[model samples]
Target: MKHPSQNSSPSLDNVYRIYWLLVALFVGRMGDLYVLLSRRASTLRTYAGDTSLPGGKRDPQDHNIELTARREAFEEIGLPLDPQKVPLLCILEPFLAGNSLIVTPVVVLILDNTLRPILNTPEVTSLFSHPLISFLHSEPPFATEPEMLEMKYHTYDDVSSSTRPGKVRLHRFMTGRETGGTKPIFGLTAAILIRVATIGYARAPDFEVNAPGQPSQEQRIARALKHDPIFREAAALEGIDPGRIPEPSALRRQVRTRDKRRARSKL
Candidate 1:
């Protein structure tokens, strides 16, 4: 499986190369396309018991971001590392988490859906699956139980970002107990799927994917690389020059134009 360049421009390669953390969105079809998810072990210090994709920080032995994602998935959920069984789809742009970790989402298609999960009990408590396309809609893929009929499938709030200059949208998608477990998929997880679905289906979402004035993910990431101390330290360790990160305003304009073209093409 070939890993696509994380950035389009050669100059931004080093800037984007410092993605020390990654998550694997294991996409498979069991009728509707689905992505395997896991509940983080409650014993862990950060985001314990929260729902997340199978991934973790890059280890010294992992050769690249793709390998880092696959290795983490294998350790956390027993996902096969064989390229034949699972092949790379595409590497989405990096997202800066509230904790200051620049996480790259590595998407992979699972050719075999029958593979059982082998949970790393210390790192993951349980595993579940959610429809990939559901993230793009306001309703669940199937009929909901009477009690859960009142529950919303997707929602978000316009919130301020400490690292980025402007407001950002924090999305939340409910995956009910009967559907997958009690936890809702929000934050980075929700944002990732919205993008994956948009690409996979080649359709605009039923609702706006971003807030009115939210900065593009690229803009936010560029801001973090330039201004955040933790991101700066990670880049330095990677021998990356923060000076090479594109200006936030330039990225914002680029993203806006690209998004407009996408929206128009869909019409």
Candidate 2:
């Protein structure tokens, strides 16, 4: 209910110049449940890989930020939410991307899951939803400072609950890895988390990082490229050169086609 713009502290003014650039965000929440969509890169070559949310740059035709958020959600995730279904809560303060575009996130609530997502393979790979309560409960223990950024991580105390009563904790972390080093989920994701936490969600305490093991999701894809015969065959059929890294657009199309065929056969 708190507007992100109205809640901005004086300290944030030092880091970013507040521009009145209007970009909209759709915050789809069902009861205590919120919807967050994760996107996998069609290929490991794209800039934003394995990130969350359905959003993009604003279009000239958009009348307002709300429309832009709805349009992007439908285009990217195939979830066609009616404008009437999206209840406008409040506008968050605009955040700047590295590209210098000022992004305005518009928070909204979606009470039902009636619409099936027909993801735009060119951008999205998969869509999954988690309970808002879970997010409200799980705490990310560690934070990463990539290069020169001075981001801080904070811990939260427990709040009382009845259904699954326990203390809820939360920790903030950098989202992506650096260019020459390991990637972390920084940038947009970090910004979103910060906004959500500050807006109202109760923070959870931090936990220890899990032990490192096999190759990560991205690494697994890379390994498959080297060894998977199925991928090789698919690449050949598509007239794509396996030795050359495929463009994200081309790879996404192939994945979408494959997924569609699989879905039809199941039907």
> Could you give the C-alpha RMSD of every candidate to the true structure, in order shown?
5.8, 22.6
TM-score of 1: 0.81
Number of clashing residue pairs, candidate 2: 18
- Tens digit of per-residue lDDT, candidate 2, span 1-267: 122344443222222222222122334443454445555554646464655566655454655667777787777776555656556666675553332234566666654456566877867666655333333333323244464245333233333323221222222332323333323434454445555544556554234221223222233344344344554554454455667865434565676788899999999
Regions more than 4 Å wrong, model 2: 1-31, 44-46, 131-185, 202-267
Give me the overall lDDT of model 1: 0.75
**C-alpha lDDT of all candidate models, in order:** 0.75, 0.47
Worst 10 residues of 2 by lDDT: 13-22
- Candidate 1 C-alpha error for residue 5, in Å: 23
TM-score of each: 0.81, 0.46
- Please provide, for model 1 over 92-190, each residue's C-alpha lDDT reduced to its tens digit, 9 standing for 90 to 100: 888777866667889888887677889999999988888888887987776677877777777888888555677778888877763544578888888
Residue 99 CA displacement from its true place in model 1, Å: 2.0
Model 2 residue 29 CA deviation (Å) reads 12
TM-score: model 2 vs. ground truth: 0.46
